[model samples]
Structures are given as C-alpha cells and as structure tokens.
Target: MTTTSGNTNPASVQLSAQAFRDVIGRFASGVTVITTCSGGRNFGTTASAVTSLTDDPPMLLICLNKSSTSAHAIRESGTFAVNVLAEDHVQLAGRFASKLPDKFEGMAFEKDGNGSPLLVGAIAHLVCSVSEQVEAGTHYVFLARVEDAVAYPGHPLAYFRGAFGRMQMAPDASVLREVRERIITTVNEVDQAIDLDRWAAELAVGVDLVHRALIALVSEGLVRREAGQFVIAPVPESIIFESYTAKLAIELGVAESTVGRVSQGQLTQLRQYMEATFEFIKDDRFTDPEAWIQANERFHEYMVELAGSKILLDTYRRLGLPGLNARTINRSTYATAELLNDHRKLVEAYENKDLGAVVEVLREHADRPRQLRARERELFGRA
Candidate 1:
C-alpha cells in the first residue's frame, strides 16, 4: 500500500513500531488463544488479530508472530483451533501469552474434529485448517477454512490500549449504585413507577442485575416486592414526616461537625456543586429530573464528606432520605424557585460558617419534602 503522500517506497516513510502499535491499540479486539497439536504435543499462544473473511465457505484469518512456537506448530500440522476467551479466562490467556514450556499444563481441553486442542470453558471455539499462509513483515497471515465452530454464553474478554479487560454482564458496585440512584430519582423526582425491563434495556445491563439492585433497595425500605414485581413502597404521612425528621437530625449533625472545620478546598468544591445546580435549575433548563436530583445530591454529599465521619455518612446513607424526599416532592405542586432559594440560603450559611443559620436552612430544606408529601397524601389519600 502507498501512503497518501504518494510514497511507494516503504523506507521513505518509516513509522516507529511503538507509535504504530499505540495508534492501533485504540481499536479494541476480542482476546483469543490460537492452539495447535503437532507430534502429540499441544502448543498455543494468545492472539488478538483474528477476523472473519467470508461466510460462503466459512473462511477466517489469523495473524501470528513468526517467532512464536504456536505459529511453527500450526505450520507443521496445518490445523489450529481458535479459543475465544471469556472474562473469567484471564489467567488462561496470560499462560498462553507467556513463554511457558507447557502452556496447557494440567489444563482441561478437548480435541476438535481437526484434532486441534480446544480450551474448555472458552466463550467460543473455531476449528480450522490452514488454506494459505503468506509471510508479511514479522508475522504470518494465515487464511484458514473453518471446519467446525461452537459458541457458549458469556461475556467476551477484550484487549485494548495494551491491557486485558472484559465486557461486564453482571453489575458491579458502580452499576448497582447507578441503578439504585435512578430508581429513587424516577420513583420520587419523576413520580413514576419502576419499570425493571425498561431500566435494564436503558442501562445495557442484565435484568438480573436490575432485580438484584431492587432487592437492595427493598432492604433499604425504599422499595417493596409485591406480586412478583418491585414497586415503591407506600409512603405514609408518618413515614414521610419521620424521613424529613431524620434528615434534619442527621444533616444538622453534619453541618455542626463540619461548620468550623471545612477547608477552603472543600468550600470551593461545594461552591462548584452549587453553581452546577444553579445552572441546571435556571429557567427550568433541566428537562430530566434525574439531572437535577444528581446536582442536589452532589451538593449535600459534599457537606457530609466535609463532616469527615465515615460512620455518620454511612448512617445517613442507610436512611435513604434522598429517595424518600424524591418520592415526596410533587414537581407540579412544588415551586422550583422556592427550592432554588433554599439551596441559595444553605450555600450562604456555609460560606459564613454560621452553624445556627445552617441548621435553620437544613430544617427548612427538610420541611419542604414533608409538606409536599402531606399535600400528596391529602390529595391522593394513600398508595
């Protein structure tokens, strides 16, 4: 291939190998271990440069470094199996990529139709016979005709930017947190029912993960399981009153503990969060209730963080006060201007290090949600 500069001579425009690898590393690829049996011994090496060439005759291609032992074995036997690694097979991928004398030592595998060793528990496997091999630079590009293929259900192992990783199917703590926050925001801020399947689809996570998160929320008293479906638990007037009461108690402690101790750095961070919240709330620019909920949470979380007590923060979080308040607020009835004004007062109180004023602002902030819930209860009667 000629460069765009019309340089047909390869030496005329030399590129550093590390630079080339770094650029191409941006293209993520699935991890695979190419295995072959020759002279009654199994040989394998981890590779990422594999692709399907066509479907008519089932052709695939794999590029192997010329110096690799697996490449020599494939040349000798003319057959190899491509074992696509799953997320759980990171150790196996490492073993194959190393210069271990026996890559498959004590490993469980089965022979394919072409007598090539296929790693057990791989996400997929492809048995192939080498149809053509062309030497290209320091690697050999082998064109193989697929003899057989098999696939199993699992997330694939991936390589990108010079590190091995996996596509996550099961929700991690971050995913669970996100799902939890969205559930509370939707149920309270948007005043909507929880839709498990819709949330799963929107978050690109398994339904099971969403179910697990809902179970956690249920334990936190933010949700309840009924008739094989998860829903927001009924908020009695007393419970709503108790929630705000708890918030005032907990947050007042936070403000008192952090009052004189808050550093300039913490204050600046809090100010930035308030600015973000103001920007979002201005002119009702935030169409999504979740965005507004997040900004509000950030502002409050910083206050709690400044309190510098893990036990206190944990206690506050376990109460699920934010979620409760979200459920209580009827956006249609509650004035955004009033809410913004509450936040403004709170920020000013913090800036002045006035503990009494901060406590007063938090009480008012806490009371609004209760009032909204009371209004809701008066109108709707009950859940």
Candidate 2:
C-alpha cells in the first residue's frame, strides 16, 4: 500500500489497473472534451483529468493518454481547448470517448482564439497554448496557460464509477425537492448570508443546481436576490401573521374538501409520519432542526395529499410555507409541546372523520407559528 521512488514496495499489496480505476472512480470528476486542431483536421477526446494549476496567470493542465489523437494533435499544433461539458452532453461525451475515425464528423463547434474547436452548450471553454508537455508513464500531462476562457451558468456533466452522469439535482423532481428542502433547512439554521458555492460543495451538487433552487425559492418568497446574491428573505411579524391567516383558510378549505374522502392508505401514511414525529419528540432529539422540520413537513404534506387537490397543494407550496415554518420554529424559544399536541389532535380528528374537529385543529395549528412572530421580528429586525 506504499510506493517508493515510483516503484511499489515489495511487501505492500499492489493493485491492478482495473482495481486502481475502481478505487479512484469513487472520486467524482467533471467531464470535459479536449479538442485540438492540426493540419485543418479536428481531434477530440473525453477527458476528466483536468485541473486548475494556477490562478495568477490562469493556467490549467490536462492529462491525456499518449496514444489518443487529441494528445497527438495538441502536441503537434501546440494549442487545445478544454470544453467543460454540461449535463445534456452525454451523447457527445460518448462520441468523443469512442475511437470514431472522425469524432467531429457531424458535430457543430466553433473555433476558439487558438483555432481549437469549442463545443457548443459547454459550461466552460478554456483555450490554451501548450506551455509544457511531460510524458508520464502512458499519458502526456500538458501544462497550458489559458489564453481565453468563458463560463456559462449550467449544471456540469459528471463521471463516476465507470458511468457518465450529471449532478443529481437538475431535471430530477424528487432530488430537486430534497435539495430545496435542505436549502431551506440550512437557511433556517443559519443567520448569516447564504453561500451557494459552499452549500453546493457540501451537498455534492453543482452550484448551478443551488442557484436554480434559490431562484425557485425566490419565486416562493422564501429567498430574495440582493447585490447579485441570494439571501433568506426577512420574515416580519406582519408577514408571519398573514402567512398563518392564509394557512388557516387553506387548510380549513382542504379539510372540508377531503373529510371522509381520505383513504385508509393515506391515513396509514399520515399515522406513520405521526409516529416518526412523536418518536423524535420523545427522544428529545431537537439538535438537528432540519430532521424535525422535514418530519413536520411530511405530516402536513400527507394531509394536503389526502385532499387530492393538486391546485390547492401547489398554491400552498408557492406560498413557501415550509420555509416559513422553519424560520418560525428555529427563531422561537418556546416549547414544541403545544405544536406536537396540535398534530396529535389533527390526526385524531382525521381518524374520527369529524370535519369540525379537523377545522378547529387546523386553525390551532396554523395559529401556532404566529406566536413566534415577536422572536422572528427580533432575529430578523425590521423587514
């Protein structure tokens, strides 16, 4: 498991190429297609071993297999362009990764300042002139000084464990929902400015995905853009009061619309959520507010789902009630016993098929967040 002077130690366990590849595959990498032009011919290959070597003069390096046409073209032409692929470039990545005679046969690409082909729709394009080329084992590491670069805001194509993929948040509804939930939860937990890049790195998602989620939050009034940065929108007392007022109206309407219509399956799901919430409460596990918030949301979401009104549920979501609830709970110093009791009453009313009791409990539940208005105002301080 050790190497000395480029040689594996005799006593250490050595790994085959496939074993090394498998182990390194756990380190996810962004996919890029390295393109170079030589003698009026285009050559390209999918690459992942690209890195930013320096930032002062802006330089990068890409390691290419010595036998690849791109490596030969870059060495001959002294220029290459690194086109960082987007999530939608899976087919293009496959084409370049193949041994196709002319990878750019039917492909459309624009030449960079260095006469290197830059693929369209790439998240970034870096045109470079090869400054140094060192042969390492079976590959040539080309150290290039970036002549020009352009970046587009988009999710990146990713490679992991021998498969081409994209970051999980974009285009996946369930993943996006979870991302959105986590973002809101984080915002609730912190009073400082939200950093999209930091959150993306921590969540193992693309910054573009965080930006998209923030934009969705903006539409819901949970986040606001200021100075080109996303921040949690301040929740004033009046807004909190107004939010609960609206929730009371909506949930009462939902209760009337569903009542006896809720199925045993839906009831069973709601009961499961209740059990989870009570278990967390019984164990006094409030250290992770995000978990409690998610459990609470699930309980309410099941109630909304029982109503079977997509329009109503969508409208409620658009109001950003989840974010509002998080803000309320996190800011308040009050005990959650009352809130837990309200939930128990809500479930009981639903089980008994009592429309009046359901409406009453929903009203009480809606009113609870309003009690946190003073604390929210103190924390957020005037809008």
lDDT (Cα, tens digit) per residue for candidate 1, span 1-383: 43433567877866667767877898999999999999999899999999999998999999999999999999999999999999888888889999999888799999997678898899999999999999999999999999899999888998999998966444467667877656554453332357888888999988888877777667666577767778776554566677568867888888877886788888888888887777544442343455676787888777887878888788767657567545654334333455677888887888898989998889988887656446655766744
Worst window of 10 by summed lDDT in candidate 2 = 279-288
Please name the candidate that would achieve the greatest lDDT relative to the true structure.
Answer: 1
lDDT of 2 by residue, 7-106 (tens): 5666656667877787889899999999999999989999999999999889999999988988999999999999999998999999999999988887
Which portions of model 1 show Cα errors greater than 4 Å?
A: 1-13, 168-383
lDDT of 1 at 240: 60
Give candidate 2 misplaced runs (Cα > 4 Å).
1-11, 168-383
Query: Candidate 1 — what's its lDDT?
Result: 0.79
TM-score computed on alpha carbons, candidate 1: 0.50
